[model samples]
Target: MIDLHTHVVPPRTPFLERLAGSDPRWARLEPAGETGDVIVAGSNFRTVRRVAWDLVERRERLAADGVTGHLLSAMPELFAPWAPAGDALDYARAFNGWLAAEVTGHDGFFTGLGVVPVQDPVAAAALLGEIAGQGLLGVEIPSAPPGAPLHDPVWADFLGEAERLGLLLFVHAVGGALAATFPHPGAANGVVFPSSIGQAVGGLIAAGTLERFPRLRLLASHGGGSLLTSLPRLDFMRATTPALQELMPQPPAVYAQRLWFDPLLFDATLLMALVDVVGADRVVLGTDYPFMGADPVTHLDDPAVPAALAAAIRVTNPQRLLTSLTAPT
Candidate 1:
């Protein structure tokens, strides 16, 4: 079985220091046995387990948990949306290279998804080819850049390029202005991140992104962050607002089904709600691995889900998602 929403990080390198120069925004980790504190710009960003970089520990966890493969996204703290294009692109290239090699070294135990500097759409567009060249399936973007909506016109070229490449987009909530508004970790992570992802996913549907780029594929983290409860209001607004309807002629939920989601909701009821909206065909098993344990429901055999549905989420869906190591043809 495959876990689609796992993460890994590259240890700091001197080149990254050279890229940053005097900038204090780059990420650094302080190891603590099986755990570590991720510090960015001199402040503690988040505490993470060693699975963030240790493939050995990860392999053990995967074996113990019965997962066969993992999709390795650069840990969310490594997504530096606020950095300047030159620094950001360079940093992203370095990180992407390390991540791709890590996946290769794991002997088929992991698949890779890299990151791009989204603040500059043009540069981010250029990086997609390099990321594709490294044999990663796709890229992981923050729900949005610091202050801009992802579906804004500035990202059109980038989105078009990604569609042409058939790259999968893993939309995790990490960037938004709310991080500055809520300085405390609990406020920033618990509520703001979820809110950010929900807004970005909804914004993409309402913006007719699918209409413009039909082959674009997306997988959202945290069960797409309250998307379970948000679509009705979105459809209500679309029906009532002529401007929205002009942009998107279909109900928001109809477009939502075309995208993918991870069942990281931590509750069977919530997972079922997401499955009902997007369908089990669109739902994949996601552990948030090494961060939220290997399996949300413990194991597929536990009966939280039916045996048939569990096999589909654990195996069938992930195979379809990773059918092409290159982009989808």
Candidate 2:
């Protein structure tokens, strides 16, 4: 099966290290033990496995997880939206180059998604050509940028360009330095991250990103966070609220069907709930890979699910989403 949501990071090369250390706002990676590195952005961020940048280990582990291929993006911690625009652009270019080079020789075994400085809309829009030229699949941007939401007028050019190029934009949810608000330990992962994705998805629909770019291959990570449960409410507000009616060309419920989501909810009932809302065609298998635990016995192995539905999530849907889903070759 093709896993759409795996993460792959590059080594903290001298260039990236210098950029982050020189600025307090940039995200920096600090070596912890021999096994991991600490990601410091707003706070002492989480440490990730050494395998994050180890392509060989990543390939072997993907094999161990029983998948034919992986769609890799840099770990969420590496997306420093708060950093200076030029610095973030530099980091993104470096990462896009490194990732494109790493995924080149594997035939179709590896696919890559690069990062961009979403905080700088004009610069970010300008880089799409360069990113597309790098042979990268698409870009992975954080759900939250600096000031305005993703669906703001400032992003129309970027979104339009992505649509024109047929790029698969994946919006990843990241809990920035504001982890203190979560209060309880691990609340950053359990609450903040996924909830952010849901908010971004709803905002985009309510704000007309999907309406403006109907065919934009926009994807939401982590089972679309809280979106499914909020669909009725979104539809309610969209139809009755005059301000929203002017902004959204289509209602949230209808626009939601046009969006794509990964079933990384880690629960069968939750997965079924997602499928029930968006239908199986919109759901794809995206194991957050290596972080949320690789699915040793994946969802496809469940006997309770019909063979047809399982096939769609595990293979057919991913293949359709990325026509170049050429893997294991």
Candidate 3:
């Protein structure tokens, strides 16, 4: 079955030295041991696992895990929203080059979803065209850039270009400011991060992004991030808030059904509920592979889910999304 939500990093390159280019603000990764600390703007942003760069081992393990094909994006921590525009674009091109080369080597076994320097929409759109021309699936973007909302005018411009190019967009949380506001300190337990994805998705729906960009296909990671459970509250709010209704012409849950989601919820009932909310056709297999949350490999075979629905989630749905590999007619 096609796994829609896996990540890969290139074999270690001189990311820092290449982008530093006399700029002190460019982010760098300082290797400590098995993992490395990411330094951005003079502060430790986060730590990354070494397995993220072990491409060959990861490909082999995916086969063993029953994933016939998977999508690869730069590790989210490397998005480097803090970098200056020139450095950020340089990093995007460099990373996309590595990804295209890897996909060319592996061909059908792996497809690429490259990254763009989202802080600059003009550069991002230009680079996105290059990525689509390379036959990669599309682009992976952070839920939002550092301090901006996903539906801001700049993002709208970039997304407009994405839709014109018929590219798919995958939204994964990168633990920005929103992650820090979670009721708990540290937010490292993985709870706050996925919850932030839910909030991001809600924001997108409220902003009428799908309505504005009808052809823009999106895949929301982490079971669409609490979306399945939050629908009742969202709809209730819509009913009470006339202004929100004006912004969201339809119910929030309806907008959710049009987007795709990865089944990484780690529970059978939640998987079933995800299907119930967004339909099996919108749910795809995702392992978050080679990371702490990779276990259980739950293939949506829960007795709670219908056999037909499970098959769709595992196989039928991904085929539709994969069609983006072809130039859109």
Candidate 4:
């Protein structure tokens, strides 16, 4: 089955080492015994196993996991939204270049989602064209840039470019400002920055961004965080709150159905609920592979799910999304 949520990271190449050492704000890969941890702006962000860098091992592991193909993206922590715009752009290109090089050889077995310097929309849009030109599937950006929310006017240019270019945009969470809320923030406690995802997504829907940009294929990671759960509330608020009526063009659920999401939430009940909310076609299999999270292969075996819907989630849905991605001209 095609897994849309897997991640692959390039090894600590010389360029990255140089960049990191020259400026502390840049991400640096510090070698530890048997594995390594990524240090972003002096804080130990996350550890990476050998498989993170070993493509051969990754392919073999995918075979063992019964996954036929998977989409590759850089680790979200490396997005570095706080870095200087030029440095962020440089890092994005490097990550995309690494992704292109690695995935080009694998072809059918692997597709790639590049990174863009989301902090600067104008520059990000330019780089997105270059990324699309490389035949990369699309680019993954943080749920929101640091100090900037998704609804900010600054993102319009980049989002506009995405629509005009027919590029698929993955709004993955990279907890920057929001992480400060937690006293102890990091992956250890599930301090995943997905909480804002719902708000960002809801705002976009309410603001009629999807309606305005009909071709923008937006996907939310982590089962769209609280998006599905918040749908009913959004609908209620829109119906009751007069001010929201102007913002909401249609029922919130209707716009939600138009977006894509991965079944990264391991709970069968939650996964089924997500399918119910978004429809089976928009729900794709996403293992969050190698994270020791939910296994995508076992999604079909969820007790309450029907055979047809399960099959659609495992295979048909992902194929549709992947096949529909705008290829480089």
Would you estimate the TM-scores of all the predictions? Answer: 0.90, 0.89, 0.85, 0.90
Cα lDDT tens digits, model 3, 189-218, are 366657767877888887778778877888
For candidate 1, write residues 113-169 as lDDT tens digits. Answer: 988887788888999999988998899998877556788888888889888888898
Off by over 4 Å in 2: 14-20, 24-34, 39-44, 183-185, 293-304, 324-329
Give the local distance difference test score of model 4: 0.77
The best candidate in terms of lDDT: 1
Which pairs clash (backbone N, Cα, C closer than 3 Å) in model 2?
A: none
Instruction: State candidate 1's TM-score.
Output: 0.90
Candidate 4: count of backbone clashes, pairs at least 3 residues apart or interchain: 0
User: Which residue pairs come into collision in candidate 3?
Assistant: none
RMSD (CA, angstroms), candidate 1: 2.5
Best-first order by lDDT: 1, 2, 4, 3
**How far out, in Å, is residue 21 in model 1?**
4.3
